[model samples]
Target: MADITHRRVRTNGIWMHIAEKGDGPLALLIHGFPEIWSTWKHQIHRLAEHGYRVVAPDMRGYGDSDCPADPASYTILHLVGDLVGLIDALGQDQAYVVGHDWGAEVAWHLCLLRPDKVKALVNLSVPYRPRSPQSKPVEYMAEKFGDGFYITQFQEPGRAEKSFAKYDCLTVLKKFLLVNGPDLLAAPRGIEIIDFLETPDSWPSWTTEEELQYKAEKFRSSGFTGALNYYRAMDRNWELLGPWQGAKITVPTKLITGDKDVGFQSFGTKSYIESEFLKGLVPGLQVLVIDGHHFIQQERAELVSAEILSFFGKRSGN
Candidate 1:
């Protein structure tokens, strides 16, 4: 963090704040739900030292980036448009894009929507989800997982914002990052999300209290409304992205995910990833199933960086 410089760059219709270092070919790191650019602290340092300019942004709705008042502003088209503007703002024709969780969703779209801007991709956790022409995202999510699902619970706007605001940001960060194993995601009536923070889960050796404070402070100031808007706008994204239906991500790519990650363990997600689904979409693709949870980059920083370096070496000849 000491060496990394922070600055705000105007992109799309918002101002995106980015943490950047190094001076070689660009490596743009996109963070996910409830996470800030700080989540990629290790990657920023490692990738920079390895001779590449690494830029990790607050990403529109998170951290120091500008957050629009409407949830509708958080669509994938908006997110991808920001990335294109970010690469352009940095004076680059293309970049090696990497994303985790929700960031992975954006990365996939970036490749599909504007493959010319991305040289290659290394995504973690969440896999590419083919659009469902049968129904809107919210409709099927409600039918299959019910309103109790985290994504569905986020649909009602202020309800989840109030629930998350019940506890301090540090506690919320701890509960979210340190949650052990994959469990069914649900927030039943009368139960606040902060309830998960009450117990002392086994401490993770990778993160320090000081680091957690940095992330907590960002969320505390920005509030959770902007982050929750990602889910709130999914249905709208589905409608807006219909033009690219049946499109495949033709970029050279590698995907890594923890066995215990919530996205990996989601019903049929593992099967789809392991089967022809992923390869059919990502023609030049590699997959690595590592041992860990959702926050695999931080929990296994050295290993994750090694994987990224190795993928760049093999895939893009970096």
Candidate 2:
């Protein structure tokens, strides 16, 4: 493994911490909620060895990155701004971007809003979704999945934080990362989402105790408010992104996900991915489904690394 280095850079009016290794054409790795830059441990080293500089950041509101107090600050515009600034700070005009979960959503918006900043995108977990002109995202989610849905439940400020405070950070991390199945995250009316999530019987085989502890410690220090703010800003993002309705991400892209991912299983995503509809939204799209769960990057680290390298190799001429 190459020596990984850590540093902070000023971007979009805040200091963002990043973990990076190797050196070549830039490969920016973005992690989702309940995780930090270390989430890409497997890919960073692998890509670096194959002549790519891999930079993974602990996105705003997670890990050592600055956590803005206002939920309003967590909008997709803010996220894309941070990433755009990050690319500039690194002295690169564009980068190969990879994202998972919330990070994937951000990556999609990054490519949509500013195609010039991304060389190519390899997004896992979440797929590209066009802005809906009919209704706000939170309202649609509430009507479709009800208020008990995790995103709907996360709307209220401090509510999910209070529920999460009931347990230690490690336990909170375990519940979010380890649990599986489609629609399994929905809480019953009057129940907290944290309590509703079934705890895993054992630790996942892919990650080590040290890694989980490092993440747990970061969450313990930062609190979950910054991360939860991403959910709270869903409606706000919908309102702001109205001008971009029906926009297609023209960047060359690939989506690799676990066959059993909750996002893949629920909300008619499987059908949508299989349908011609997705190709229309992401015209440069390529899809691959693997036998794993939501945390496919870590759960199937070697395979994920190889797949990313292969896709990037073709584009980067490595």
Candidate 3:
């Protein structure tokens, strides 16, 4: 295994921590909710060995990065700004951006906000949801998925945060990282989210106890508010992105997801991914369905990295 390096960078008015390795065209790996850059532990070394510099950041919060106190500071614009600034700080004009879950959402918006900064993108979990002209994201989610929907539950500032805090950070990370299937994620009122884990299986065989603890210690020290704030600012992002209505991600792209991942099970996500809905948003997009869980990158790191390396190879002619 190749050793990874760390650095704190000033970008988009905030300081962020980035984990990176290798020395070639930059590949910025952005992690999603309940995870930090360490989530790409497997990809960093593998992708680096494939001759691409891999840089994974903790985003604004969730790890050793600066956590802006206000939830409103977490809008899509803020996210895109952080990434654009990151590339500048890295002394590069562009990077092949790879993201998962919320990171995927940000990557999609990053392509829209600054296509010049991203050479290509390969994302996992979330797909590109075109800007909606109907209702605000939070209200629409509450109406369609009900208040018990996890996003809705997180809306009342500090509500879900307090609920999540009741569990040990390691326990919370284990539950969120290990979840499977495509059930609409929700938390009943008054129940701590950790209670929903059901049974904690022995740490997924892919990651060791030490690996889990490195992630757990970050959350235990930083808490999860910065990460959860991404959810809290959902509607604000919708409002802020009004000008980007009907925008399509024109960058070279690919989406890989576990067949049973919750995002795939969502109402029509699977069909859409395989149909014109996804292609309409991302023309020439490649989609791969893997037999695994939502955390596909970690659960099936080799396959995920291979897909990424293959995608980069085709895109960059490496």
Candidate 4:
């Protein structure tokens, strides 16, 4: 951890802050909402020790990275462009990419839009869903799960931010991070999501008070608007990425998710992952379902790091 260095690199019209260590091949780690580069601290140390450079960036809106004010700026193109520019800025033509949650969504598009830039991929939580040509993402989410659905509720610019502001940053983080199941995510019709989500009396053994405070402090300083803007740009992404509809992610890939992860449990994702559907889209794709929740990398750090090492090491022939 002491060898890890932090700096900002200019890429895709913005400066991105990253935490990095080691010096072999690049292993780009992209984080999801409400988190920072430190989320991969465990992986960084382990992967570096195993002979690969691991760079985890706070994607676009979170941590010390630049936060563009326009929701339109957070589209899939912008997100993928950021990573493409990042790979170039890092002096690498290709990388072994790993992402979690929103980061996984971005990684999927990165692989789709520019497979040349990704040597291989190991994404967590979110699986690749082929674009639906018939409906925009936000509208589709509304039709399928109604407005109270978290993603649907996140559509309105300031709605979720206001709901989140009701609690202190620490409590707000706790509400999201400590959630144990998918069923607890959606609010009951008119209820605000942050208000609906319960805060646990005790913290999980995998995470510490220090880590939570660090994440809370970053969110408090940056505010949630930029991060929530990713959700706000869902429809825009659907519009802008129309050309990529039904595109296959040809890169060798692995999808590792917790059995209890909200993304895996909700929206018929389990069936999607289990069926031939996912394999049809990601050819040669491997899926690993483990015990834990959405933040599986952090919760099961050793297993996650080992899986990553195994997958990428094989790709690199190390």
Report the lDDT tens digits of candidate 4 across residue range 1-318.
588999999999999999999889999999997788988989998888888888999889888999988999999999999999999999999999999989999999999999999998999988999888888878877887776788888888888888888899999989888889768367788998888888999989889989999999999889999999999998888888888777899999999999988877776788898788888899999999999899988999999999999998832333
**Candidate lDDT (C-alpha), each:** 0.86, 0.89, 0.86, 0.89
Q: What is the lDDT of residue 254 in candidate 4?
A: 96
Candidate 1: C-alpha lDDT = 0.86
Higher-scoring candidate on lDDT, 1 or 3: 1
TM-score of each: 0.95, 0.97, 0.95, 0.97
Q: Report the C-alpha lDDT of model 1 over 61-112, residue by residue, as the tens digit.
A: 8999998879989999899999999999999999998899899999999999
lDDT of 2 by residue, 222-258 (tens): 8999999999999899989989888788999999988
Residue pairs clashing in model 4 are none
lDDT ranking from best candidate downward = 2, 4, 1, 3
Off by over 4 Å in 4: 314-318
Candidate 3 stretches with Cα past 4 Å from truth are 188-192, 314-318
